[model samples]
Target: MESENVDMNIIPPQIAGGAMDAVEKRFFETEAEAKTFFENTSKRLLSVNEWGKYAGMSSFQLMDAHGIRADRTAEPGDFIRIDIPGPGTHAGMGYDWVRVKEIKELSNHEEQISYIIVQPCSHPMDKDGAIAHFFKDDATSTFIIRKFGLVVSAEEHGRNEIPNTDHGKFLDKSRNFVVGMAAKVGLSYPQWKNLVKGLLQN
Candidate 1:
């Protein structure tokens, strides 16, 4: 079997610089098995809600997540709704929303790669509402699945930007401060790591 590197050019600099980065990989005995697993795993990666099942085994679980497709096609305009349990929920701040910015696929005789990239965005239901988004638009989360020879890898790559809003100039300093502090203290890495593990689980 031939060995080749998964393309890293798909990752933008902003996401590459993200504060939280996590990755996980699984190896298969045969390239055919790896290809089969890649197809199933890619679907799971795109179905954001199913993440809970895989991450549930970890102490830090992804409690709630949903994907809102723009159309039946499941393209770039879709949205992901994520609820992070904490003060934000207690205060009725609402869930975090990220827009699907890109869905890319690349392939050759020896390899196949697929990824979805999302960036923080205003809540789709209430764009002008008072709900404070936890991350700035500059922040991104990329979910990737790559098949190379007899190995498969799943990756989550993105940067966390300070919390801000796209709807208005009103900034929630208190909430942003808390989230910023959490990001700095490395509160999100474990969750992301578990999420990546969930992606590669058998």
Candidate 2:
């Protein structure tokens, strides 16, 4: 199929009964554009393009079938990175996931930003069986919200991974996104509770 931005027109079931005003998560690649969008968030919601990615697969399963083997493989500290097939239900529309190794608070442009260096488990198992490691520690694959097969004994599974491939930006911008959106509109985003009480129409 010809790849293009997912048309917001195709509404997901979650919004079938008006459960959500919209499920579109705007992402921008650059901070300036993201900020500009936020400045006028109230006028209309425009998703910023943070990053462009694809598992280079037809769908999530294509990547899995090619070379995805996270089953029982690494530890919390053991370095690991694998392309897990996104269920494509939520977590925005994207094709790739970032496997974070560790997070550090560093100063950039005099601003404190949380940065992570992850081994892109894209198929780089070293002699020691590590995808990518720029750190001193060998145990990485298991930490954070990474997806691991049964080999590592990770959580059942996660809907979203930390440091999303297209997750984009640092903490400052992230916090700003929330605060900015709120400032744009007098109301805050809907709370997750709606799903529990069935308050959401859908």
TM-scores, in order shown? 0.76, 0.19
Tens digits of lDDT, candidate 2, 1-202: 1123422121112211111121222445666654444334311111101111211222211122233443332222232332222222122122222343433322223222222233334232222332221111221221111111211110111111222222223432343344324422423122212111121111
Cα lDDT computed for each candidate against the true fold: 0.64, 0.24
lDDT of 1 by residue, 23-87 (tens): 88898998789989999888777766576566553221121224333323335777665666554
Q: Highest TM-score: which candidate?
A: 1
Backbone N/Cα/C clashes per model: 1, 26
* Worst 10-residue lDDT window, candidate 2: 150-159
TM-score of 2: 0.19
Off by over 4 Å in 2: 1-81, 84-101, 121-127, 130-202
